[model samples]
Target: MSADVNTGTREFILPDLGEGLTEAELISWKVEIGDEVHVDQMVVEVESAKSVVELPCPYAGQVVSLHANAGDTVSAGQALLTVAEAGVEMGAGDEGDGGTPASVSQSGSSTENSSGANLIGYGTSEPKTRSAKKRSFGGKHAAAPAVPTVIPDAPSQPPAETPASPSNSSTTANDRVSPVSSPLVRKLAKDHGISAKSLPGTGPGGVVTRADVMAAIESGAGAAAHVPAGTSPAKASSPAASSDQSDRDTRTPITGLRKVVSERLTKSRQEIPEATIWLDVDATELLATKKALEARTGEKYSLLSLVARFVVAGLKKYPIINSSIDTAAGEIVTHGDINLGLAAQTPRGLMVPVVHGAGELSLRQLRDSVSGTVGKAASGKFDPSELTGGTFTLNNYGVFGVDGSAPIINLPEVAMLGLGRIKDRPWVVDGELTVRKVMYLSFVFDHRACDGQEPSEFLTFVADCIENPISLLPEL
Candidate 1:
């Protein structure tokens, strides 16, 4: 929605957080009503698809109204807050002649500074590239874009009655690229196999919002979306029906991150013919090696980072598992940059934080990266971009006191390596029964990409590295 003019207040629409992200859940408000706020002041914290981002307000004014409450899922371009500032007018800079917000411009200059925090897409727009660009996560999966200088924070759901769009931003179906700046809208379109270009957008400047895609999906556009077996498509819940059900049971509406995880896992299960294999390994040597390294260097290294070293080497030796399937292209895409992801349970939910280029990092650098990213994940403060572009994932269910698990593979990626709890278990050492520090490695792979042998070799290599840490030196 574009900025609305009241006598003195100016609306601050949710600025685009680049990587195709369309909506975010409001976590908390940093400022209260009537509080004085400066330009670039952190106004609120929002949780995008995978990260918690603090949105900075661009206008310096007295805080007026918060359109949505905490935990509200705000769509991109929706009105978030209104500011009443002196000398602030509904100028051309605030919106285009057609009344659409300027945030839709996908420029290369993103974030406050080029060397600032790991933010989303570029911000500065060139006159030639001022056209509304299709928003996408950099890879198969992406985070939200940055808030541009012209636009500040945005969003709450629009009113039940749809607002009329400006006449210039018409939705005529010609040979035009649909102005889809929201990743959520694109995702909904792709999930239903509905090409957005076929439908007319109701958003400002003809940008496709999630609602338009949903309407097209409901209208039976293109291929029918796959509904989970034994489950029918969900319908809009009636208030009366929901009220009656609430008396009998506590039914929480599934939305936001939980909804995303559910959909992603369902897709993974439906599309992937994944097979799991597990083996117990003697990790006594690996423990000793970690302790020895710490004692000599007087530096701390986590088991995860140390194990990551082995996983990195194993991936190099067998790169087939470090890949994703391009369903549209019918191609198996192997990644040159090994972005390592770790699956962990955070307060928000199960999130896989990614380290962009894990393959090139040394053991110490890997430890630092893993530690920093994992810590941020635990606290639920990691940047959204850090959650995308992962080639492989490592799950340490061991910390949960579990021996083994057949975990679901993160989508796009073909494989996931699971580490079980290590304990003193009796093992055969040199043909003799002896107590050793043992752990289980559970490997899951998409059978579509490779047969059982490739993953078996990769798993065996990882297990060997754990059983004999020194054996990894050759690969080093």
Candidate 2:
């Protein structure tokens, strides 16, 4: 049904989610057509490359229409929905039939009117303008002609159809804009050498989807057919192509967080010249200290929290490890505040949640921060901010029963400290061999950021602290 015809309608465009993200997959819409929505109320949920986020409505009004459906990928600055503010007069051109104003263009093009809607942390708004002459794929439902004014109590009659001509068809093809919701779908069509504008979309409002592009490929409308007749088709059957898919019974498309992780790790390896150093430390004292503390205070003190304290202390002495290399500027960037990122594994994938101002926190505070952040990450409730801005990373791969690993350096950060499993090992104490708790500490650092001297000393200092837990008492 139509909203109040007298009310002015404002289109809400999708705001840019941070970290240089250009688009997001629309997970679901919280509001429906004709539903009333309040300012700052969550109206939609979207899955970005990093995480899932709920977007709040910026204007208070009755929802006139939803521009994209669930599972559609939408770009930044695209119209998300229309809200007709209460008690505003609608212009003659803005009126719609059956009480619902046409919030979106029937041609499936983005709206052109600029609405200066602003959301906090996301910058200013811009209009997504469409061309004057609308184009469409061949469909049973044609676009309705624009009505300039409505006469009072006029009889509702269908507009007369105009006969199509050969010239009109040619012009339509030349001017045709694909009814695609996402840039990804368009890219798929282009990659397969298929014209999206020529394909009839089965999606709502006739929007082309990725599945449609795949269907075209399966129907022999792929890039191979578009090749010149004289060119050999050897490229398609090359050894490289077969090797790329060799022995893989099942293949999963890498998207979302996994894709982001792959890109970041790839960049890290390509850019950072890294080195790893490992040392086995006598952890008998550290384990005893934790047990003593727990018994004295009747509180649980995790070994990870204790080790994190040692890492913070070590960072204070070796600040260069907390720095990042800006290769483009040919400079080393050092951070004043230490944001400790703890790597935690969840069902979604590996995630590093950062604890801001970690160096300033006490042992108990660090424990609480680590516990809380890890809990949120495991439950998939952590914010994107928590996943970034890490000055250094603390990895406890020991939980997985590993002895040592050459951990890759987290990008923008120069180093990562890994703690391996603490187990009983024979140790020589006063010339007698005895069983003692031992653990391996693997320290990976960017050689460009600092020489071996600093990282070596840092690892030794941490090892000494673990061997003699009482040494940390002065700092505590």
Candidate 3:
């Protein structure tokens, strides 16, 4: 099968969305085939490993075709779509010339085009410019006639075969490659001793989906009568074996922000040698100070804001804790400004939204910044840039009623401070036993960046501020 190739049609391949990421999942396409798109107009939305980003078209023309559908994972440098230059005539190709136009197969692979257009970080096609009259599409010019295009049909498949005799099928099913698109579906098939290749896939292009695998299992393909060797027949045939139908377990693929968080946490644990030290601090004075300030000025000040101020003051004294490890340079890199990361729990997950220059902000400013950033994170409106470049992390787990945790250090940052719930506890003050409001402060640091003494001193300094809020006045 061949397509009518248009010489003026330019193929736009997916460009590299930085941080060494190789691919992205198509979320949705904003423009359809035969639609006139302007330069810099958003064409599609894609979810990369980091975040969901909208891709803009670089050239102004009519969208000739879409290469992949929504939910399809496309690799960098792969053709995404084709756009025909406005006012350009379609010319027939030579009979001897054999090339497939930018077309996508039912199997989700594209036919390579030698004359494909390229973007930065991919191929080497130069950018082309049309005449000024055809440069921008507006009003009447935008209403181009919708040209009907024929999309190639998915490959044909043979008639479905019934389950073969156990002796012949078991080995054949296990050895054959499964035409599955998702890794999770393949895993499910393997766990049940079911061969995905033997089952007729109801998904596009005969690709096996999770639903198809489950259907095969329900149809007795994974019956205990044909259980493979070394497996318990009783366990396989039991009602519990089919309990997955009751929604006992659910598997969700880690993608988008969650995937990024997983990779970053794994890298931090593998690369950084960390140590945690915790101390209990009297927070009666700090709470009283906040109340007094709010009453006198008619302005509310959060405990987190006060704690953040104390952290900044402590960082000034022990600047080493505010530094990050530059492994590539073999040095500890310290910053002149403090970008404080406040860990907030959102509906999606935990995210650390950064306050760019916390050292320069007053208590009120700090309170506002924390509130605004947290609001944005909860609504999923915060930009990816706002989630990065944090020099030190301040996690207030106390809100969740937790007392303490040996929190992981947010890399490449050297340290993270955890604040536990403040509760009234029996304490000795001036040789008398009394109830005092106390909180646990857990400090974790990268041992490579600083020795035990510096972090200990930093934690102690913050603890002192909490105990005696008057001491923070001078620093403020």
* TM-scores of all candidate predictions against the true structure: 0.67, 0.73, 0.71
RMSD of each: 12.7, 8.8, 10.3
Which prediction has the highest lDDT against the true structure?
A: 2
Instruction: Give the top-scoring candidate (TM-score).
Output: 2
lDDT, model 2: 0.72
Q: Write the per-residue lDDT of candidate 3 for residues 20-125, one digit (tens) a residue.
A: 7777878899998668987667899887765677887766667765655676566676556666666644334311111113322323222223323334553333
Cα lDDT computed for each candidate against the true fold: 0.70, 0.72, 0.70
lDDT of 1: 0.70
lDDT of 3: 0.70
Sort by TM-score, top down from the best: 2, 3, 1
Deviation of model 1 at 99, angstroms: 18
**Candidate 1 to truth, TM:** 0.67
The residue ranges of model 2 lying beyond 4 angstroms of the native Cα positions read 1-7, 85-178, 183-199, 210-253
Q: On lDDT, who's better, 2 or 3?
A: 2
Mark the regions of model 1 whose C-alpha exceeds 4 Å error after superposition: 4-8, 87-248
